[model samples]
Target: MVRGVVRPHRVLSGSWGEVIASNLDYHRATFRWKCEGLSEAQLRRRAVPPSELTLLGLMRHLQGVERHWLQRTLAGTTPAFPPYKTYVTAAGDEWYDDSDPTPAREVYEDYVRACQESREVFARATADTARIVPNTEFGATDVRFVLEHVIEEYARHVGHADLLREAIDGSTGE
Candidate 1:
């Protein structure tokens, strides 16, 4: 568990990479805070009827997102995490399927680890570093685009998490 207060990103001024990284780091910490101090059952509770969304699922999904974009697309290699490998082949809502029986601690730990690895990937990349995104209409793309896309993705999901967390236990904040 992260001790003490996790400081908010001071996005006043920095390089392009620093700005994007700070924003990404902020969102990542926000997501973690939203999920803190929840039991396994609480984490797995669905948001609404007929919806599979859960805090646990969101964490798992973000883990996959980090691995796919940072490890696979940017680094051009397979995901190092075995759970993610299983998720890629699992049928029917792989990320949200609570039937997998994996421990909530494992899921949360994977997310934290994946975020750290993603920071490393970004650290090695400059704004202009080019990486070929397979199956995209536009062949090669720059690191800036990937970083921006990650920020956008996390922003959207964190919004979802806010609602889900509030619905679960009435706790909410940025």
Candidate 2:
């Protein structure tokens, strides 16, 4: 077997692809877990001015991402959950959230639920290299691309979340 290629009909990985995919999943899950236990106001508070990179907003954004990649792209289905257009801007305005102010409990519940749904979708597609759909950026895709991108996206926001949460009340770490 090639060093980076799968054994075919089985998945034993001395492979770059599988390794990266595994790491991606780890980081993505870590990002979600890190935001737990913060309040709604804390999660939604804009730490940096002119930037709405709140933990709640990140949750909503990641929900939209999961819908796009796993549902729309992979499953080829319409969004099962509501779209989070509240934080989306028309253009050049990445930070604009306008959702109803839910209690911390409610917000956390929704975010956690979304992550569960996404996990289901990811698990259903058996192959890491399964080509669910084409992405504009990644172009041709396997599940690996989706997994990696999700991790990348979440990692970026998690760093922001770390700072935001720390600024709120001095709590930190994953």
- Model 2, residue pairs in steric clash: none
Segments of candidate 2 deviating more than 4 angstroms: 1-25, 83-99, 126-132, 136-140
How would you encode candidate 1's per-residue C-alpha lDDT over 75-168 as one tens digit per residue?
6667776443234333443444666688889888889999888888776644455554552523567666776777878999999889988988
Best by lDDT: 1
Cα lDDT tens digits for candidate 2, 11-112: 247565556446545555555555656665666778777775677777667776767776677656676665334544667444426455555465555655
Off by over 4 Å in 1: 1-7, 84-96, 127-132, 135-140
Supply the TM-score for candidate 2.
0.70
The 10-residue segment of model 2 with minimum total lDDT is: 1-10
All candidates: TM-score: 0.83, 0.70
